[model samples]
Target: MACLSRHRHHHHHHHHHRAWLTSPDPDMLHHRPLSAHHRPLPHDDALPPLLRTPHPPRLRHGRHRPHPRPQFDGPDPIWDAVRQEAKREVVQFNSLCASVASIAFLVFHFNCVQAEKEPILSSFLYASILAHDCLEQALVFVLANRLQNPTLLATQLLDIFSNVVLHHKPIQRSIRLDVQAFKDRDPACLSYCSALLYMKGFHALQVYRIAHALWHQGRKVLALALQSRVSEVFGVDIHPAAKIGEGILLDHGTGVVIGETAIVGNRVSLLHGVTLGGTGKEIGDRHPKVGEGALIGASATILGNITIGEGAMIAAGSLVLKDVPPHSIAAGIPAKVICGLQEHDPSLTMKHDATKDFFTHVATNFRDEMPNG
Candidate 1:
């Protein structure tokens, strides 16, 4: 049976390939299974045209060359920050210096304006001449020192003292105040220039200021030398160690003597022949301390370590040995407080005369103090 009927059958196996590669539709690629070993590459059509296309090689001397890296020619950010900070600091410092200079200039200008208001300085030409005179006087002082020493010390004295008295802040302020005081307080003072030039009191005070500075700076010999010159020329013997305050008016300056330890307060007025001295040869703070705005008349002598109270008026030729109360009138030998002041600032008024009421009060007190005879 097997030899008579023999039949044969064949089974065919086909491998599946990606259909999208040959087909027109690319959407069919997603339906096909991917291989585990490889990922699907993005098609050139998925990217923008500019990025999809390859750049052509550059030709230099008929050879292909690649593009070069870009360079930066700008300043560094950190350096720029540092430079800006430095510039800011410089501006701040400059502004500070300018402010200081402006203040100093304004003060000087104010003083000049005050001077110009006076009759003597009303004319600009007169003011200029006065300025010239002041300069000449200053030069004379410098020249005198130079002739005496002929050394570096003498040569630099002018510059040194000028800087201290004129440019120095505190001293300059004191000087301005003094000039204003002279103009306001003295009837004879015509202008600032006159006070600066011809006023022996002012000259003596200024010389004393320089000497005071020299004394404190350990230049004792120079300080004493200046004191001697002041005594000789101005006839106002103010010891360098005397602590005199600003706005002092030493009227008629001659015979005005301030002791070594005397303390004269601000706005105090001293008429000619006023003496602030110690009793006998007493040492160590024996000199009087005159309070502010006190008026000491001509030939009035304040002795020992007495405190002449503020706004006290000591009559001319009075001898003050004890403390005088404030705002009171002290007159006569060994000076007694005769009456209370209706006006406190006798210094400002420059008043020295005794009123009729004052004389009556004094006589009444004298009669009462006298014993029965």
Candidate 2:
């Protein structure tokens, strides 16, 4: 009985050991149920593609995928259009100048061939027209005749002026437009060559452009000097800091005073003695802002920081103290709005006559509105 009991006890111990090895403890298998501070990682689907660390699947076909392209912004369309127009104008003006020069050369050659006498006129023509290649070279030669002095030699001045004009694309465009403006607006300007060779208004504008460029570059002393020269030569006192735009027509430009803070817009016309000036001793921004397509008649004095509206007409000798409305005809001493203007630009028409009936009505209304005192 003792031997049988020993055998059963051994058998039971062996069975218990087998069961423990076959099945692990439930608490140990679960890994002690993660602590409150130790949370499980987020699923791959919850993360952004860039942040996710999952491996990409292998392609069945052996081809690789192409990457997507990046996008960028381009230049403004209006500015691009402006640039294109300027380029076209420059090309046309240059071509016209070249043709004129060519014709002049042919005439000089014919005179030399036909006449037996000394070719004095031919020599002059060769020096003036046949010698130069472009409008800019001709301008440099012409300006040199007047601008050369003891302190600044003609050659040195020419180099400086050429560098300024050639380096600046805007200056070239402005020059072409200014020439076109003269041709379009001034009756005296019979030809492009005549405007280039003779017009004081055109000359003054080009000098001012150079001075303005210098002023922007922080060479104020040289700019002021050029301004003084322009004033002396052309009698047009345009401050170097004044902002004048393209297609400007300064008719009989003598005594035209544009102040330092003045702003003249594109396609504007100003007759002789027109002053875009300050009213008093005030400092900052104390000048007139002349709008596009506005016409200021001869001797019109527009003062202060007021706006002369687009397509507005200020009658001759009028003194404007306040803002003029757009497309309105302003007249009288203090310059009241006499009547509304037509859709066309008055500057282009070169017309100063406001309707006589409209002027009469305005005068009548003014008298009626006045007190009995």
* Most TM-score-accurate candidate: 2
Mind giving the per-residue lDDT tens digits that candidate 2 earns over 1-373?
A: 0100000011111111101012222211122333453233233344322212212111223322111111113212212122222222222333223332312211012232333343343333233333332345446555655566676666556656766775665675566667667776898876555566578888888888988999999999999998888798789999999999887888878999999999998878899999999989999999999898899998999999999999899988889999999999888788889879885677777776674665677689999999999
What C-alpha lDDT does candidate 1 achieve relative to the native structure? 0.58
Model 1, 102-125: lDDT tens digits are 123111122434433442322222
Clashing pairs in model 1, backbone N/Cα/C closer than 3 A = none
Best candidate, lDDT: 2
Q: What is the C-alpha local distance difference test score of each model?
A: 0.58, 0.63
Candidate 1 C-alpha error for residue 53, in Å: 82
- Candidate 1, TM-score vs. the true structure? 0.57
Runs of candidate 1 exceeding 4 Å displacement: 1-157, 354-373
